[model samples]
Target: MRYSTYFLGCRVNQAEIEFFEDKLLKLGFEPSKDGKADIIIFNTCAVTNKAEKESYRLIRKIFATNPSSKIFITGCIVPLNKSFINQVKERIVQDNEVLKKNVDNIYIIPSTQKEKVIEIIEKEIIDKPHFDSLEISPKFIQRSKYYIKVQDGCNHFCTFCIIPYTRGRSRSKPVEQVVNEIKDICKNIGNNSDFGAEITLTGICLGEYGLDINTSLAKLLKAIIPYIPENARVRLSSMDLITLDEELIEVMASSPKICKFLHLSLQSGSNRILKLMKRNYTIEQYLDIIDKLYKTIPDLGISTDIIVGFPTETEEDFNLTLEAAKKAKFHRIHIFPFSFRPYTFAYQKMRHIKIDHEKVKEFEKKLMILSLEQSKNFITERQGKEYDILVEEGGYGYTHNFIRIKTNVDKVNCFVKVKIDGIEEEKGNFAVAKGLVTLPV
Candidate 1:
């Protein structure tokens, strides 16, 4: 069977899709060709109403376009959007012989049952029983970077988030299991120095990793540090402020294998808006951490999420967010306009109060401008400095602190030490530092 995959959410979802792709490849499946894939696995997201709608729409489009392909829909939307599931089912009920022949064509697998998807396909999908007997290995297409999902779900239940409802309670893979997985990955990839550039430990809530198994993320890092190659690096996908502690910082500080960049999700900067959102951390706490985080981790590039138009957000609230962004010196800011999502407290309590659309657009523009300005400062701070970067296929790689630098170096999947020779700022492109590789005489 041949397959195609799609996902529309965070890094956690991206990691899950990569896992599915590897699993399916091992099952004698090839990439889609001959004008139609035999299967399509779409990992959907429902973080916002727009995302949810697009997820369903994409599903419908896939079904319509790939009539012969078995469609598997999974992820956050699988549990929450039953009406859309029923809509698909209603179409399946139509009097069509082709559809009836493959009445089981569409599989709606929930997050809870994701692990069983391959098992279901193995048993149910006819004439594919010898998949396990064949000697096959997954060839990851990406030249560099591997995303390993160490944790799943979240327990925080932020008032504005539907993730808790969709992903359920926080849980983790055992420390041994994760370690073995990494070992196997390294073994398969080898120390060729031409691959294995980076591995990202991803999760819905990464900081809570290993809590159920009597360990912590900090300890997990300490354990894995010895196994990772000195050239390759490990990175956390994102972490909530509530569980982030000094221990994690200390781990990052001690290791050269761990990336210095941290993407901490700070939803809103205004104290009042934060209270309304029921976020556990306050602005004071966030700013203090920022102050300490930069002091501890040298050249650390901090990025964050900021919501622009929460219903109760005022001009003061927006201004406060701008000020906070400036103070944080965030290299990147993901500005998500407040989206109305069902089952979230914000949706239930303040649905009637709406922020002006024009204001939301204005806020987005302002934040983006500030993000670039801060990023310029970050780039300027690192200029004329030498750093090792793992060159990806595009001839560009990020430094330890996630500085994107384009270089003349074309060696893919290998680390090269380059000094930032010049900074390029163009209208459309993100500011990229020009790198010149320095070789020993």
Candidate 2:
């Protein structure tokens, strides 16, 4: 059987889809590359209205192209939108009873029950399990780079978010399982003999990992360090300010394998807006952490997520955010416009705080421009410096400090020291550099 999997939303979704692919491959399914497949699985997202729209759009496009293929739609979107799920179920029942056709071809599994996807496929398509349960090693799709999901779900219910509703309460993979997974990945890399692999610990809320258990992320990192290969590197995905502490910073700073990059979601810099959004930390606390991180780790790349045009954001509030952005000088800023998601507190409470749509759009434009400028300045600061880049396909790679560098080096999935010569283009978001030398593992 040939199958294709598509995912939308965060890195966690990406990790899940890859896992699905791995399981399907183990079940004797070949991955279809030319958009023609016997099975099409869509792991959808519902982070925002736009995301939901895009998910539906992609589903329509896929169905049009592959009309004969069995379609499986699952992920965060399915569980959150109960009406949509019921609609899909009703349609399937109608097709089965009224048309006397097998409705098993189309399956809808919620994100919570994603583990049963393979089982569903087996019963619905194959009529039985094709293979016995076998231990499968983690696969690194991104040439020598792997994402390990150490945690899943989120606990915090920020006013402007619906992730908590979609993902439910915070939960974590056991510490032993996480460490063993990394070890297994390292073993696989070692056996491949192509190159070393870097593992990125990803989750919906990474810092919230191990909160349910007795251990913490700091403790988990300490435990995994000894088991990891000497050449392998580890990276933390986006984290919240509340979960970050001096101990985790110290652990990262002391470890050579940990990437010197941190991404924190600073939705709004204005204390008033932050409070309205139900964020625990203030601007001062966030800046203090940033200062500490920069002092502790040399050449550290600090990136952040900023939300513009939040509810009750006045001109003064926007100014405060602007000032904070200027002060923080984030290497990369992911700017998002305030999207009103249903069932979120922001959606209910923010109706009275009306800001013009045009005004919100303007603020978004300004913030994006500022972010680009900041990125350009960041690249400019490293113009003459040399850094080791994990050369990927397409002559592109990123340094330990998370600077995207484009080079002419043909080597892929290997390390190379690149001396930054100049900015790549007028925007200056990426640097054009020349490879100085290939670095050994």
Candidate 3:
């Protein structure tokens, strides 16, 4: 049997697809380089209403293209909403009413058990030629760096978010497993003839890496760091403010192999909004964690997530968010207007302030402008500065601190020295730097 898979949204989805690939190979299924396969798996995301809709659209398109192929739908989409699956069924029926009668082999991959997920992949490959068991890994074909989902799911149920219901609770891979996986990946990369790359550790909540078993994220890092090859880099996905401790900061600051970029998910700035969201940190505590990291990590790049237009977000609350963004001067701000997902606590409440569509757009626009201004200041500070850039393109890459740079030479995935040029008046600061910078001996 031949199989191919499509993953949508988040690193964890990608990681799961990689595992499916391993299972398929072990069961004797050949990987379809193109979409021509006996089975096509759509690993979907349902983080938001838009995501759910998009998942359905993708599934329909895949089935239309390969009408004879067996289709499997999985990921956060199936478990979160029964109505959604019904809607998907209707959409397919309306499009191809006659075909629906013959398409009776549809399967919804179970999410509650990892064993079930594996079983589906294995069954899809049943009766195929047996091959050696392949290690669960991603192909470094594009090698523009990688994301290793070191953990899965989240325990925090922020009022506006749907991830908790979709992904279940937080679970951490054992320290030994994580280390071994990374080491094997590094070894595989060394043997590959095509490209050299590094892996970034990602999770639903990275700082909670070892929380399930009382092992600290710092301890997990201590285990994985030594295993990554010196030539390859390791980056963090997102850590919470409450999880920032001296040990973790020290490891990040001192490790040359770790990228200086940190994404701390600060959903909102107002204490009231924070409380409503059930976030564990106060604004002051979050600020303190950022301060500690900035003082220790030279030229660190801090980015954050901001959710504006929450259920009860006031004009004052939005201003507080602006104030914190200015103070933090984050290099990146992924500002999103809150979208209500069904089944969350905030969904049933009617007394909260409603965000008119026009007003929500205005707020998000303002947020983007504020984020750009902070980025401008960061680029100004680094003007005429040099950095060790991990080259990911022929002549383009990002600095250790996560500032993007472009050039016209063969510089992909190789560390090179470059001088920071002033931010271009257009395209924001993502296009600065004259070229690679040499490190001082």
Candidate 4:
């Protein structure tokens, strides 16, 4: 069987698809580069209205591209928005009875039982590893340098997020399993080429990695760091500020392999809004942690997520968010407008507060501009300073603590040395490099 798989939404979805890919290959299935395939699987996202609509469109496109292909839809979207799945299934599968029978193979699995999910993936989707062994995909794989999913699901049920409902309770892969995956990845990279890149361990909430078992993230890091290649950089994906303990910070600070970048979620800067959102941490506590991280790691790439307008959010509350953002001077800021998802606590308990759509857009624009400005500050201050840059395809890439640089180069994923020429801080995006970090070919 030849199949082309499309994954939508977060990194976790991508990881799951890779696992399925490995299974499919073990089953003697080949991956399809183009749309021509015997089967097509879409790991969808319902994070936003746009995402859901786009996911539907992509499914339709997949069906159109290969009418004979058996189309399967899975992931966050299917469990939450069954109507969307039904619509797609009806379009593709047609007969109701056959569709029901076929769709059973694509239902979203619970995160609790890894062995069961693994069995389903191996038997139904793909049974063999895509490669003889696990291999890291190309750099354009989207989010991280080397993506590793150490954790899954969300326990912190923030009023606005649908992740908990979509993904269920928080679950951590066994520490040994995670360590083994990292080791395999590092070994694969070593065999392929010299790409001394970072590995980002992602999850719905990363800080909760070892809760189910008694192991802690600090211990996990301690155990894995020794085995990880010296050249490989390690990064922790988004984490809750409330969970950042001294032990973890100490591990990060001591290890040069760990990128000084940390993405913490600060939904709102207003305590009143924070209460409404049911976020575990208050604004003050978030700030205190931010302050500590900055003081502890001077070159830290500190990024955060901020929601512009939540249910019942006032202009004053929104203003507080802006003020807090300014104070934080975050290296990168991800701003999102509130979206109401059914079955979540926020969807039912509180009356949906009407927000001026125009105002929300305006606030988003303002924040993006501020984010850019902050990024500019990092670049401006670092001008003429030499830093290690990872060469990316059609361009060169560099990371100044947390900022990324895209250079006009030939090689992809090769780290080189470059001087900071200019910065684009308004969006907190990047800085221009003066020259290539490598010598002439």
Arranged by TM-score with the best first, the candidates are: 1, 2, 3, 4
The parts of candidate 2 lying over 4 Å away from their true place are 80-84, 88-104, 129-142, 191-194, 352-355, 426-441
Each model's C-alpha lDDT? 0.79, 0.77, 0.72, 0.69
TM-score of each: 0.91, 0.90, 0.88, 0.86
| Residue pairs with backbone atoms closer than 3 Å in model 1 (clashes) | none
Candidate 2 at 233: error in angstroms?
A: 1.2
| RMSD (CA, angstroms), candidate 2 | 3.3
lDDT of 2 at 198: 72
- Candidate 4 Cα errors over 4 Å, as ranges: 80-144, 191-193, 424-441
**Candidate 1 overall Cα lDDT vs. reference?**
0.79
Per-residue accuracy of model 4 over 1-441 as CA lDDT, tens digit each: 787888888777776777666555645668887769876667778776667668767766666556555566676655534355455455544554544454543434333332344355455556533333233333222222666787878887887777787677878878887778777667655633346566778888889989988887888899888777655667778899887889998888888777778888888989999998889777788888888888887578788888886877778888899889878878678888877766677778764556678888887888888777777786677777766666666665657476576555666765666667674222233334345344421
* Candidate with better TM-score, 3 vs 4: 3
Candidates 2 and 4: which is better by TM-score? 2
Model 1 spans with C-alpha error above 4 angstroms: 80-103, 126-143, 426-430
- Estimate candidate 3's RMSD in Å: 3.4
Best by TM-score: 1
For model 2, residues 302-333, the per-residue Cα lDDT tens digits are 88888877877888988888888878888677
Q: Kindly indicate the candidate among 1 and 2 with the higher TM-score.
A: 1
Worst 10-residue lDDT window, candidate 1: 130-139
